[model samples]
Target: MAEATAHSIDQDDFTHVVKGIRYPPVVTEANLEAMLNFDIRDDDIVIAAYPKSGTNWMLEIVTKILSAGGRTDASSDDMVGKLEFQYPDEPRPHHVMLQECASPRVILTHLTPDTAPPGIAHPQNNVKVIVVMRNPKDTAVSYFHFLEKIKFQTGQKRFPSWDEFFQLFMSGKYNFGCYFDHILGWWQRRDDPHFLFLKYENMKQDLPKAVKTVAAFLQVKLDDASIETIAHACTFSSMKASLDNSRYRGRAVNARKGIVGDWKTMFTDEQSRLLDSKCKTKLEGTGLQFNFE
Candidate 1:
């Protein structure tokens, strides 16, 4: 297990982590205006989730659905091209790319409530938003491993242990902004006709059902056979293997450990308790709970 440091750090240092990859402490009025003014069609769909919360998995599922039983003859690379990130400068740009694509766009984003594009929050907008969530313990563990690999590949020597990483995560000092604020914002709006909430563990436990649920939300029709094919194709093992040897090649780090509950091996009892306490406090009355144990 990783140990937390007793060494004290200032708020500025902590806030720096939250701003990582996002750059610019604030999104700025100009940026928000640009995003809100952008054209959004009625047929568009957005996949919104926190970092390391199965956003890619949901992207794969939506791509497969749009492909009509995964027989569109497009490679995973082609599918990746279709499912783009909305936040370009941020850690994940899939959501931005999706916005630029043609009709029936499936964009992914990690923006918190405050940072969510103005187009998404507009009542007149017809696009559907699907939000996915994972247990914070698991999300923290996965995020730490992801950052470690990033540090290694980028030649950065400073890597925090799992416990240290958890503290930062709890403090709302990770990329894509605060986790509590992000999920809670979406959770509160989950009852909207255009919003759907999906859990990572539930998707991993039964992907076909999850895929079908998403398809239904998008009003996309998929036959039983097509559903099975997508379910099989989106499995963590299949995606990991496919991504491992794709044209993108050597860029598939952290894609292999896409299983649910992997955090069990990475978090200690104390760390789990700390995370659970934070979750309980932040998530209260939201009707959103996690199976950390």
Candidate 2:
């Protein structure tokens, strides 16, 4: 089964398109339709971001907040809040399983707004969403490493080298599509009462502040001590230490170098300028800005 899954992972340039958006091969049209039509509880929380934009970190922080510092092991990777995925061995899509779980479900996805459930980002459903963003340069670098690490651990053939990977990323043909389009889709909806946009750098710089903000947004009030505890527990080092490698495939990929501007070490001058040009042009009028460092 592992070999078969690995073989499929090598299919079609390692990604499959759903409704014009690229996703991992694990996402199926049937499962995506199920997810799109899935019911969202009023109290549900959704975390949306492009791949490797500190998604796991935000999930940990929000999960801890929801539990009042208590962890929800049920919220682990196999869980359906990943919405678009349909694991190979599983009999059903993740969303079908999620349907059986109790509310207020916490969903995490790398999907852009259009492909995600309509009510997910809309205030009409009363579901609160936290949108996390990281500078695209760092996101591209991290995503490249994530794919590399997955290929190494799984013995998957046909992985791209750094140069090839960067070109794929720039072309926006990689999983989850263009970083600019994904984030900008959510950024435009930032003013809605149901949405809270966060920067990865800001969270890393002052996690306690991030924790407080998330707690408040979720209406999960926490004392100063509780907030401090959550901040400590959700730190990159702390979360990495607590990872269960057996349970989470490619788990280390989620926690790698959770720092700002690591892209500086990897991006060449030409590559850096190219990304900058893309960002500047795409984000020209939007008030949104990123701290590369």
Candidate 3:
């Protein structure tokens, strides 16, 4: 299988069309070969999360922890580049740019269960994986805003309204198929010594504890002061402010709103109920429940 073709849309219709180049429903044969057969380092870690579910937040935290004793040159763009997408097989020139550095690589991927690269599931060395889960309602709201910004920048207007976007999300027509499936697939593997499941809500509720949890899992140690600094830096407010004049320099496109439960302000009661119902119906018996209320 090859990468999924980019869906083209007129400026007027961009609101309804999904942006970004889609990959094949399954991993391409060549990409799968490269990933499964590649020699992975024991210290490497993978940060997996659904879109708009604090993936970048976790990446920033992990990067800070990993780069603590290093220089002050760590920037958001560097983090993004080092944290590669495990699937899709596209040769990321940016990754090549970052690979020249001596830092340990941390990969970020959104590949669903069936589509994830085999190496992530079965590492040659003792690699660790961290999967983050967020409430689907908030994810939907954040994703809709993200798509709107993408449409504006790409000069495409295919984005659907909040209502329509909610429907598409609930229907599993968006990327990564159903949200519940993505969460459960990784959740089931939480017991694997290498797998750690981190909930966005838990992180938000207690960031320091979350940081310690992650550090312990990755065998990365930090003193109390270092952990406090990292926890403070990873807060939504701190991240949002950092994007104001940070090195990433794409605030308008990437880091618009970083608060949790923004969906409550964006979605109506009816829409909320509908989404709640869909999540409950589809997510039953998965041993995972999202706080959509």
Candidate 4:
């Protein structure tokens, strides 16, 4: 195996590759090792999404639905849940911290299926998984803007220009690896009863219906009134306001615009065609399709 590269956000920010997959510097070799052995409980609900794909929005909706509008302490961070970073005041890694949490934990991760907890990979584990995916074009555009935001905050160019980012993203050289690989890894397991596949576009189209689907998947019953309330609270504006006042103290949630086809404004015609052709080839015969608009 290649040596893991160490990077600091205060210094130069760079990604490292482990087992041929790229990840942020926070996701160290030790963390990846622990993640493989991480134990998942029966009632745990794991929300898996590629970065820039409505992860926090789904997290809010699911937690609210699970708590029946009551307060929930379920923590949702892409890296923390995957043991990529240790939380403050928490002595152990996140995977270890999860073991001490109460039952029916709402776990969030951006890890691919193979790298996620082994328990969720099996069909009979009783762990419910909610995988959220977005069209690659929009995802790429959003992710590029997100990186730029990070660069601005860190006062350093953490990533390349849009033209260079497009090439790196297409080659799967960016953090968390390729978008297509992550989507397909979980997409192949969509038939498992405990697994539920969601599209960000679909959720934006009718959030109340999406809430109902998630509730049903978790076996949590909710009336139309409750669904509407959760949907309203999960809207982009509402959630952004809540996050703005949140004590979590992480970087921005990067939900800018939150609309589909934003890629049209950013991507050149050839770039669009390139992504379209790549998606067409990767997703062919999988019966999975995405709506650009």
Strongest candidate by TM-score: 2
Best by lDDT: 2
Q: How does model 3 fare in lDDT?
A: 0.65
Model 4, 188-228: lDDT tens digits are 99878889999999998998999999999888878899999
- By TM-score: ranked, best first: 2, 4, 1, 3
Candidate order (lDDT): 2, 4, 1, 3
Listed in order, each prediction's TM-score against the native is 0.80, 0.90, 0.79, 0.88
Report how far residue 83 has shifted in candidate 4, in Å: 4.6
The runs of at least 3 residues in candidate 3 whose Cα sits more than 4 Å from the true structure, single-residue gaps closed, are 1-39, 69-76, 80-103, 244-252
Give per-residue CA lDDT, model 1, range 18-117, as digits (tens). 2232311233334433554555677767778887888777877887787884334444455433122222244533434455566666655566555556
| Model 2, span 104-146: residue lDDT tens | 6788777777888877846465689999999999999998888
lDDT of 1 at 66: 76
Where does candidate 4 have its weakest 10-residue lDDT segment? 3-12
Task: Candidate 2: give the clashing pairs.
Answer: none
**What's model 3's lDDT at 98?**
37
Query: Please, what are the lDDT tens digits per residue for candidate 3 over residues 115-170?
Result: 56576765545688889999888888888888776555455535567766676677
Q: State model 4's lDDT.
A: 0.77
